[model samples]
Target: MLPVDAMITNQEKLNSLATECAFHRFSIAEIQAATRNFHNDLVIGKGGFGKVYKGRINGTRDTTRRIVAIKRLDSFSMQGAAEFMTEIEMLTKVRHSNLVSLIGYYFDDNEMILVYEYITNGTIEHHLRKADAPLSWMHRLKISIGAAEGLNYLHTGVGNQQGVVHRDVKSSNILLDENWVAKIADFGLSKFIDQQTSGVSTRLKGTFGYLDPEYYMTGRLTRKSDVYSFGVVLFELLTGRRAVDTSFREEEWNLAKWAEKCVKERRLDQIIDSHIKAQISPKCLKEFVQIATRCLKSCRKKRPTMAGVVLALQQSMALQEQYDSSPQSASFTHIVQHLFSGSRLNSVVSTSASAPVTPIPHRFSSPPVTPSPHRFSMSPKLDKIDPVHLTLNLVARATQNFSPSLKLGEGGFGTVYKAELPEGQLFAVKRAKKEHFEALRSEFRSEVKLLAKIDHRNLMKLLGSIDNGNEHLIITEYVPNGTLRGHLDGAHGSVLDFCQRLEICIDIAHGLTYLHIYAEKKIIHGDIKSSNILLTERFRAKVSDFGFARLGDAETDGAQVVNKVRGTLGYLDPEYMRTHQLTPKIDVYSFGVLLIEILTGRRPIQSKRSPDEKVTLRWAFGKYIEGDIMDLVDPQMKESLDIEIIEKIFELAFQCAAPTRADRPDMKVVGEQLWAIRMDYIRNGRRG
Candidate 1:
C-alpha cells in the first residue's frame, strides 16, 4: 500500500482562508443582467451541479462588452453550498494561466453562481467526442499538457501554496481557449492538502474507468488518483475512444486496460484514430504510450508524480523533435532512450497478446498526408457594428496632414499613418488615390456590411471608413505589434519562439475559418500573406486588410469566383492565376506561402544571391520531395524547433499549395491542420 498523508480538517484554516481572500460578490440583478436572466439560449455547458451560461458584461475600456461564462449551481443538487464555497475559497487562493480564473461569484438568497473568464473553444470532451471537428493528435496532447500543468500547480503548491487536489481530473474538466490553449476548470470537488505531504486519505469518489484501484478498493485517496485519471485521458487521446465505452468490445470496454495490453503488444498503430494516424511519430507515440502506462499502474507507488509526468510528456515531444531533425541516417528507433522515470510498459501488462503486432519502425515510414478532417465551423460569430465614422478634419489633426513622422508603413494600397483623435485615442489611417479610392467608395457600404458581418477575435476589428468625394480614408484599430512580415525580417529571424509562431499560424487559420464558413457571407480574402496578418499586444494573430475580399453566394460564385487576377507575385495560386477564376483555394494557396515564410523566415521573392540567382521554388520543392525538409527550415530557428511538427506543417503547406484546388484542403481543414501543428508543443508545455 502507498503511504498516505493524514487529511487535515481544521475549521479555523477554512475560516482564515475565507477571511484572507477578496472575492467579487455579485448581486442577483448583476447575475441576471450578465446572463440575460439565466436564458436557456446562452447555455454553453451542463454539469451535474447546474448549467453554465455565456454572457457579455460591461467592463471594456469604453463600456464595450466583455464576455464571461457563468456557472449556476442547482439549489437541490448534492453538490450544494459546501462545494460552492469550497470552489470559491480554493480559486481565490491560487492562480495560474493554465488554471481557470474565477473572476467573481454570487451568493444571495440561496442562489449561487460562479463566473469565470470565458474559454472560447469549450471543454476537451466537446472537441474529443461531440464536436464534428476532431482534434488532431497534437491538440489532444496540448490539452493533456495544459491539464497536467494545472494539476502540478495544485500538487506542488504553486502561488498561494494551497496544495489542493482537483478530486475530479477528467477531460470534461479541461477547457480550451481560442488559441487551443488548455485550462483546468471545475474545482467543486477539490480538496486541500498539506504543503509538504504526498496526498491525503479521503472518500472514494471519481468518474468510472479513471478511478485509482487502491482509492476505490481501500479508500486511500492520494494525488496518484489524479495521475490514474490523467492516464485514462491519455488513453482516450491515443485511441480516440472514451474512458468507458459500452460500445467497445468487452476486453476493450475500459480504455486504460485495453491500452495497457496494446502498448505491450506494440499494436499501437492498429488502435490509433484513423483521422490522426499519419500525424503521430512512431517514436513519439511509443514514448507517450509508455508514459500513460506508468500513470495507470495499479500500484499507486508505481505512478509518477504530476511533475514527473509533465517532464515525461515534454521528453516525449522532444523525442519526436529529435527524430524529425535527424533524417540523413534514417535510423530513428535506436536513438530514443528509455528516459522517463519508472519504465512502466513491461510491468503493467500481465501477459502479451498471443499475436504480437509488428514493431512500427519510425514516423518517416508513415504516409505523408493526414486524412481529410471534419469541418470546425461550430465557432460562434463575434459581434460588430457599422464603422465609427470620423471627420476629415479629425484625421488631418491626428496625422499632421500625412507627416512622415507619424507614418506607419507604405504598401500597394496606399500609405498608412498613425493618428490620434481628440480624445487622445490612437488609430491607423490609410490614404489612397481618387480612382482606387472611388472603387473603394462604391463598394464601401456593401463591403463594410460584409466586413461588419464578420466578427472573430482572430480577425482585425474595423473601426470605420471615410470617403468625402475628394479623398478616401479608412481607419482601423492600431495593432500595437507590427505585421508578421516585420517580425520575421532580419538576419537572425528568430525573434518569435516556436510556440509563438505556432499560435500565430493557428490564429491566422482561425481567422480564415471564420471568414469562409462561419461569417454570414462566404467571403474570400483575396490576399493572404504575412504583411496583411497583424499582431496584437498579446502577440495574437489577427487577419487584417479585407480591401481585396471577394463576396460570394450560390447564384454568383457557383461555389467559385471569377475576376481579373490580383495578388502578390509569389503567394498567388497557380490555378487561380492561370485560370482567372477565383476560389477559396486562392487563400489556401497563399496561406501555404505564408507557412513557408514562417518555417524558413524567407520572403516570397528572393531576387538576389550576390546578384546571381538565389533559392528557387523548384529547388525547394525538390528538397521536400527528396525527404530533406529540414533544408528548407530557417537554420537559426532549427535549434528550438519541433522537427515532427515542422514536418507536418511542411506537409500541410505542400497540400495547400497543390496544383489542383481539390488537392488543397478548404480553409476549415486548413485551420484544423494548423491548430494541430501548433498544439504539438502546447501539450508538452514547451514552444521553443
Candidate 2:
C-alpha cells in the first residue's frame, strides 16, 4: 500500500480526471431508467456528431432533471481515443465568462459519455432563424462583443502552454445563456499551437461556411484564419441570413456569392432579414456591408485582426455620440426641405396670419423673412388662413397635464413629451425647465427663425413652438425610434451592422454640410454625441438639439477663447478642450473620434490593465495601424464581423481622427464617400 498522503493525492487526481471526462459512474440500469430506454419523447436536439436527450439524475432520496447532449463515439470512427484525449485536455483548462462550462461524464466498456452545462436559451443559430422575435441590432452588437472577447481570451490567454484555436466557430457553436449572453461551444476541432511554432502549417478543419479559405488552400493556420471565419459570422449577424442555403440551387446556394452579387447590384436590401431592416440605421447597414466585403476578400493578408474587428464595432457606437453633438449640415437641410416641401411646411406657413410689418428706412428696405418658393404651394387662397391658430390648439391638447407616460425623454434643455392629435399625428414637445426659461426662450426664438428659413431632411424640423406664461415648449415631428445613444447602450439591440453604421455617419456628415455651407447663416453644432442624434422608424438620422449652436461671424469671439468646455467627454476635440478655439474643424475632430469608436467598439477612455496603459482610442490607433485591428473591436462582435470592412472603416476613422484637423476630410466629402459606398452595395446587388 502507498503512504496516506500519496494515496489521497492520487485519489484527488482521479476525481479531477473523472470530472474532466464527465464520468459519473452511472450504472447501465440507472441510465436506461432515467432516459426511459432512450425514448423519442426524451430526445431534445440532434447534430452531425450526436443526439441530445433530457433525463433525470436520481440519488437515494431525491431526483433532479438534467439535460445531456450525448455524442457517442463509434467504435470504428476515425475520431478515436486520441481525439477524445485532446478534447478532454482542452476543456479541462479552458474556462471563461463566455465559454460553455463542462460537467460530469461516464466511461464504461466500449461507451463514452460526456456532460455539459445546459444552456436553456438555445443556440445563436436559433435567434438568427426566428422571424417574429428577431434579434435587434443592439443585441447583435452585444453578442458579437461578448463572443469575440471570449475567443480573444482563448486565442491569446495565459498559460505555460500554447494558445488554442477553435477550428469550428459558426453560429451553431455559439450557445446563449439565460440572459442571451453568447458562450462559444463545440471545441472538438480545436488545436493548440506553441508560440515557438506559431507559423506551423496544419490540416484544414472546419465547417464550410465558416472555414477560412486561406487555411483550406494553403494548409497554414494563423490567428488571422480565425479572423476570416469571424467575418462570415458578422455577415450572418447583420443580414440575419444563413451562411449556406441549399434552397437557392447551384448558383445562389453560396451566401458569400449571393451577398456579393446583391452588393454589386445595389440590392442588398433583398438579402437582409425584413425584421432587421426597419430596426437598423442606414449608416450601420453601410458599415456592415463594407466590413463584410473586407472579411470575404480573397486575400487573407488584407483582413483585419480580431482586435481590429472589435474596435470597429466600438467605433460605430462612438459615431452616434458625435452626431448627437453636431448641428445639421447643408445636405441635410436640402433633404429635409425636399421631404416636406410639397405640403407640410407650406400648409402650416401659408395658412398662418399675415406677417406683422416694422417700418424700415429706404436704405434697408429688404424683407426680414424671404419665404422660399418651395416653402408654399401656388394656391393663393389657401395661404389666407392664419397658420399660428391652426397648430395652437393641437399643441395645447398634447401638453394637457403633461402626463408622465407620454413624456418622451429629458436633456440639458428640459423634458420632452409625446403628443397625439385628433388626426392621429404624433409630435415631440420639448418643454423648457423653469430654471432655464431665459435660455429656452432664446433657443425657441432662434430655432423658429432659423428653421423657418432653412429646409433639409437631415436637420430636425421645427413644427411649431409655444410661449404661454412660465411654460415654454418646442414641437417637432415625433421620431418613434429614440436617440442613437439608446441603441449604442444595448437598449435597441446588439451591434449595428457595419454598413448601417457607416450610413449613419454619412447622414450626420450631410446634415453638417448643410449647416456649414448651405444654410443662410453658416452655423456650428457646439456638441456632437450619440444622445443628440435621433433616428426614425426607417433608421434614417436627423440632427437635433441646436440650443448651443452658434453662427460664425467676424465679430465672434476668438476661435480659441478661454471658456468653459462643453461636450461629451469621449468625443470632445482635444484642440478645443486645451485652447478653447472653436472652429468647424472642431466638429470634424469630434466626428473622427466617433469614427474610431465605430471601428474599435471601445470607449474613448477605457482603462487599461496597468495604470500606464493608454485607454483613449487616439492612443490605441497605432496598434490597429500595425495590423492588430481585431484588438479594437468589441469581443461580442469578433465572431460575426467582416475583416475587410473593419479595415476600411479603420482607415476612415484614422483619417477622421488624425492628430491635425487639417488632415481630416470635410463633412461633404465624408458624406459623399459613404453615399458612394452605399451606392456600390446597391449597384452590386448586395443591398436590397
Candidate 3:
C-alpha cells in the first residue's frame, strides 16, 4: 500500500539510528587485525580497568605506519557506557604540552578500545623505583618544575572552558615525553569547576600519601589540595625514600614524619639519596627540603601558592649564578695588597681634581673600562704635574690630619677608619697604602662604580668616595651591630630566635633575587657566606663586599672560571675547587653551609669528635639519617625548640648542601620554603 519513494526514506532513517545506538559498530575483524590478532607480545601494561597494548596502525591504501597505545577496556567493567561518554567528552576538550593526548576510541558490544599517544619514557613512578636507573638532581629539579607548571596550568590556565582539578596528582599519573619533559596523564578522575564556584565538594579520593589531609577530613577540594600532594612528590625527590615504607615501625613509617624528625635533629644528610650526595650544592638541597616540608604540612591553608612555588625555583637558580661568578678570596687579597702598596696620599690628593671619573657599570653586568694613562697626558694643562706631590697631600687629609684615633681596622690593603662628617653622619673610610697606587686606583674605581649602582636594604650602602690627591678613600655605611660572624661569636643571650633567624634568611634571599633577576642586568654575589652577610640592630641580614665580584659573560669572563680558589674555606664549593669552574651553585653551597650552622648551632667544621664520628655538619647529617638525630641537635637549644620546625629547617639545610650544583635549588625557592615553614609554625603554635 506504501509508495516506493516513502519506503526508501523510512529505511534510510532506520539505518542512521542504528549507527548511533549500536555498541559494536566497529567490526571485530578490523580491531583484531589492527592489534595483530590480539597477540600476547603486543601487551605493554595492565591495570584494573583494562590492558594497554602497543600497536602499529596501517593506512587503508599505502600501509603507512603510526604507533599508538591501545587500551582495551574489560567487557565486564562497572564503568559502562556512561563513564565512557564522560571520559570521551572531557579528554576531547582538553589539550596542553604537559598532558597526554587521546587519539581515537572504539566501542564494540563486548569490549571498548582507547588509543593514546605513545609516551616513550613511561611513568614517573618507574624512574623512582628503578635500582639500576640513575636520576640526577638536576633532572629531578627539572621534573619537579615541569610537573608543577603542568598542574598549575590545569588548575588556573586560561581557555575556552573552566579550569580542571586533577584530583589524582601523583607520581604515577605523571608521564615523561621522549625528551624527559613531564606530561600529566589520566584525567578520568579529574573534575571541572565552573568559574563561579570557589571549590568543589566530593567523596574523598586520591592515593594514600598524596591525599590532602584537609580534603580527607572535609571532602572539600581546592588548588591547595594539589599543593599538598606535590609536597609528597617533593619528599620522594629529596630523600629517595618511598612515601609509605612499611619496613620501618609505625612511628617511623610515614616519610613526611620521618623527614620532619630528621630535619629537626639537623640530620637531613642521613635521608638524602647517596648517589647524588656529592653532586648537589648545599644551598639547593636545603631549599628543596624546606619546600617539601611546606608541601607536607598537616594544614593545607599554610601551603604556598603555586605562583609562589615557581618564583621560589627561579630564586634558587639565581643563587647558583652568584656562586659561579665570584672570584677567589686570594685574588681579592692580592688586589687589596696592591692597592695599599702602590698609591701614596700626596699623589692621590694632587690627582683628585684632575682624575677622570667614569661611572662604573651596574652589578651583574660588565664594568666599563677606564681611559688609558696616555689620554690624560694628551691634555696640555695636566701634562706637566708631578705625581709624587699629589699623593702626599691626599694621604695627609685622609688621616684626619694624621690623628691616630681615626684608625678603624687594619687589613691587607691598609687601615680603615671611622670618619665623622660635618653633618655628624658616621662613615668607614679605607685608606690605600702608597706602594700599591695602580691597584688602589683600580680597586677604588671598581668599588665606587659597583657600589654606587647597587641599592639593597640588606647590602651596605656606599655613601661616597673621597679622592683628596694624596690618598684614595672609599666610604661606606657603618653598621653599629657589626659583622654576622662577630655577633654569632660574642652575643651573650640567645643570639637569634627561630623567627629572627628565619627573617635573616628571607632578607638575604630577597636581596640576592634582586641582584640576580630584578636588577637591570643579572648580578651574582660571588662570595655569599655568613661572614659577608652583616646584621643590623634588628638582626636583619645585609650582604656586603663586591671586591671579588665579576660580571658574567662567556666571552668577556672567559668561560666561568676562577683563577684561584676563592671564598671561605669551610663554605667553598667542592666542584669549583676541583674544576676551577665557578657557577651560581657555589653561592648555594656556601649558603647551605651557613644554613646548617644556623639550624644545628654548629660550625661548618669541627675538630672535637669521636674516632668513628664525622666532625663536619655534612657527616653529622648523614648520621642523623641513620636514626641518630638526637646526637646532632645542639645540646643548649634542643629542649626549647619545636621538634617539627627544627626538623624542617634541618631538611632545608641538607638540600642546600647537596654536592651537585644542579641539585641545589635557587635562593628564591629557599626563601619561600623558609617562609612557609615559619607560617606553619605560627599557625600551629610551634609543635614540640
Top candidate on lDDT is 1
Estimate the TM-score of every prediction: 0.46, 0.47, 0.55
Candidate 2 overall lDDT versus native: 0.62
Ranking of predictions according to lDDT: 1, 2, 3
Candidate 1 clashing pairs, residues 3+ apart or interchain: 142-683
Over 4 Å off in model 3, which ranges? Answer: 1-41, 56-66, 75-117, 121-416, 431-445, 467-470, 491-494, 554-559, 608-617, 627-640, 685-688
Better of 1 and 3 by lDDT: 1
Q: Per-candidate RMSD vs. true structure?
A: 21.2, 21.7, 13.7
Candidate 3 residue-wise lDDT, 1-688, digit = tens: 2344543553354345335533122345656776897787998776645677888765333467667777777644444443454455556666677778766666544556666778888777778776378677667777787887787667656354376777777777787878888888766667777533447898887778678888999999877788888877777877677778898788768877788888889998888878778767676666667666767777764565554454344334434333344332222122223333544322111111112233221111123222211101111231232222223233334446445566544433455566554445454656566566565565456656667677778776765554544446566665656555554554534466566667787787777766655655555566676656767767889887655555545453223865665555556665665567766666767777777666555656443554233235445554434324455665545346655466656656656765456556777777776776777677676633
By TM-score, the best candidate is 3
lDDT over C-alpha atoms for residue 237 of model 2 = 85
Q: What is the lDDT of residue 157 in candidate 2?
A: 66
Q: Which ten contiguous residues of candidate 3 have the minimum total lDDT?
A: 371-380
